[model samples]
Target chain A: MEIPDKSATAPDFAEPPVFAEPWHAELFAMTVHLHKQGLFSWLDWTAQLSEALAAAGKHHTLDGGDDYYAVWLDTLLQIMIAQGVTDDSSVQAMQEQWRNAYVRTPHGKPVRLADDGAD
Target chain B: MPHEHDDHNAHSLLPSEPALRVRALETILTRKGLVSAETLDEIIDVYAHKIGPHIGAKIVARAWIDSDFKQALLTNAESILGEMKLAGRQGEHVQVVENTANIHNMVVCTLCSCYPWPLLGIPPSWYKSDAYRKRAVREPRAVLAEFGITPSQTQSVRVWDSTAEMRYLVLPMMPVAAAGCDEATLARWVTRDCMVGTGIPKAPQI
Candidate 1:
């Protein structure tokens, strides 16, 4: 694939990237967050999820989009958080801590925290 | 202690799950030394894209639109990600790389498919290609050029080789038209391959 000139473009703010755990663990965590927030009742999430997975199964045996599902699950959690679902203290605490620790950073020039001056 | 060393040795002696799986597969191809790499590739392909990139795309999309949130994303991706609580499963060292005019960056885990599932989601197919991994560092411009991204002569292309300890995701620059768009709408323009710096965001319709 020919790489396009991204310099011609401006930066898009996708979710900031952070590395603390594995993808599936993140997926699982998001799902739990959703449940805690009550965006989707445990029963409803399981049902809709199973249905989506099942539907995905007919086309591709492996649910390759498990990460996507994790995102979908995360989206649900965000929606619930936005919608004022459960708001369990544990979930709120986690979100708060996450917000403080990982999410908030000064924009521009890629925060220099990770890069040590020395090679 | 020596006991710890011995335990480490014992653990090392035990084959990892992926190693075990590979060996099991090799056993099936025992007659032929050339095991079809495609088989393993296929499996990884399904997992990386179907599950990984899909989740990542959402994170990237959301960051593009939300300012206070975008600031949060850039400052400390891991912990902020912990808010979404989606860090850690396969990709533990997920790092975000923001693309800029003077320079362009992309990531490649040449050794393995280490990725930032919590943020960018699953990686794309070309990300795992030998051609990309081998040449990205040596000839980044050419490699990215192949993907339709041509950085200026003055622009320095830095390729971050991903490792188990450090993975990368691109905080792709937002499109000009994305000014008033909602996160979900803007996400439509953030393609998975683009997040990895292998492609550009789709042009807005006139």
Candidate 2:
């Protein structure tokens, strides 16, 4: 089959490279850190991710953006909970703590759980 | 894009849901002494700056100028990369497929984004796009066309599906115009897309 010349077409390549947001990188690093800490094996991690992707696939097409990373985060949480590393309540509590910290944090100041009187 | 609103203020006082979740997870992990913040920051820094397409470019450039290295790369990329201290994490197993006059190779992770991150860093957003993952295999020519890459009729397109077990990198053919160029000069011509097979290395400008 003769492929037509389509060199003139220009697709935008100016989009954010690698991580679009700080949290994406943070979430990714945390997963890797846990794996390195023997919390879960890489094989286990990939399996969980694959399962998450399959589950997500049932809803809609994954854009591999926030939706994809959301699945990634879910996989991390699932593995962590399954491994007895942490549970839903603790994660929720920490999330609430962070929410409060960030809300009260002044602009350009670092948000920390310590600042919010939560350890 | 779901993150369009957050884009307006990267440092917004109101953190997004994902941001909060990440922070929560980090705190939980840190409190238990399971992980450290410094290590997390180091890992992120490595991916953001230390590792990327430029590393792959150097490998590709060396292969272009050195026949022995090229042969070694195609046969056992993982070991060659390991010898260079570039093999680890997502790059545990890698295969380098060469582009020739008769064959062209492209890569896609139809299941999820299983790229050789140690070499290419995090994949470009488009590589993970639903449209790309679905179409790249079903209609490679058309998808490549969208990337402005139209392989000639005589050159067959072969799409390699990347997975957690195996990853593939396309060793683009050195442009004829780049003859006699040094490795550094040759590396400059190779882009991330070239290694991914979505686009070819740019011809050197005279």
Candidate 3:
């Protein structure tokens, strides 16, 4: 079955507030700025995002726009890896380090990375 | 002894997956020189305080104060906004809807979260959720009630599901007392939910 083009229909949207985390907007602007800066082309970004969306569609029912950025970040990571901007290992390393940090933090406390200790 | 440490202390931690992902992406991009730390800092500054619904409030404030602009915004948002840098990126094409004593407008992206980023920054979590997308069209009255908005029986709700190409913003009715208020003061009456058509502009403080 072909993927239904969502942009075709202009259903009346609702009053969901703009309460996304500041980081969400940060990630969004960062990507847009990079696209503008020509680190990657718009076509390239869209193609990746489309492919990501199709794959996501195959896996589960999409929660409308809820996971849009999650898919977006996935596509971005894939592209960055493909372009050799950074290696997958480095990405994994960072993820692991942060996960470790989160696993140790308490509820409502500011989670922090240990100092580089190079000092 | 310092060299023995591996970029972390035993007790320290990160807060969440998203925090990790954002930081990791930033680190990678900065390391590769694809984007500068300054660029990130500037964008973050805007995210923290400047962009998002605040821009929309400013636009609404302008509309409230200027009849011609209000007309332009209602008729052809893209054409009017095209003159300024405000209509870029996700806001390539926007159609503004007005909220009067009779009609109320709201926006959603049933397929994806296609928001007017240039004006509203990133969308709030609730706007991007499936529940709102599904229910917004089916039971707008209930949704409005959830937001503490109880429109009169004569009031009609109109939802605009934002697509990848175009988006929408609601022009909430100007409060009666807002007539003489300055732009900033008037803008304060415009909440983020008002742009989504879920809330109404409040009167200036007592």
Number of the top TM-score candidate: 2
* lDDT of residue B99 for candidate 1: 80
lDDT of 3 by residue, B162-205 (tens): 76677888899898867877666677677777887887876434
lDDT of 1 at B181: 59
What DockQ does candidate 3 have relative to the true complex?
Answer: 0.18
Chain A TM-score from candidate 3: 0.68
Task: Give the TM-scores of the predictions, in the order they appear.
Answer: 0.48, 0.88, 0.72
On the 0 to 100 scale, the lDDT of residue B40 in model 3 is 68
Number of the predicted model whose DockQ against the real structure is largest: 2
Better of 1 and 2 by DockQ: 2
Measured with C-alpha atoms, the lDDT of residue A81 in candidate 2 is 89
Give me candidate 1's TM-score against the actual structure. Answer: 0.48
Tens digits of per-residue lDDT for model 3 on A1-119? 22233421221223343334544655776787788777776556665676676678667755544366678777888888888887778888877766765666554566545543221
Please give, for residues B103-189, the per-residue lDDT of candidate 1 as tens digits: 677877654345665555445445544456557788888888787887778767778887655677777777786666555555657
Model 3 residue A90 CA deviation (Å) reads: 4.7
Q: What is candidate 2's lDDT per residue for A4-80, written digit by digit as tens?
A: 22421222133365788899999988887877877777776777787778778888988888888899998888888
Candidate 2: segments with Cα more than 4 A from true spot: A1-15, A114-119, B1-12, B204-206
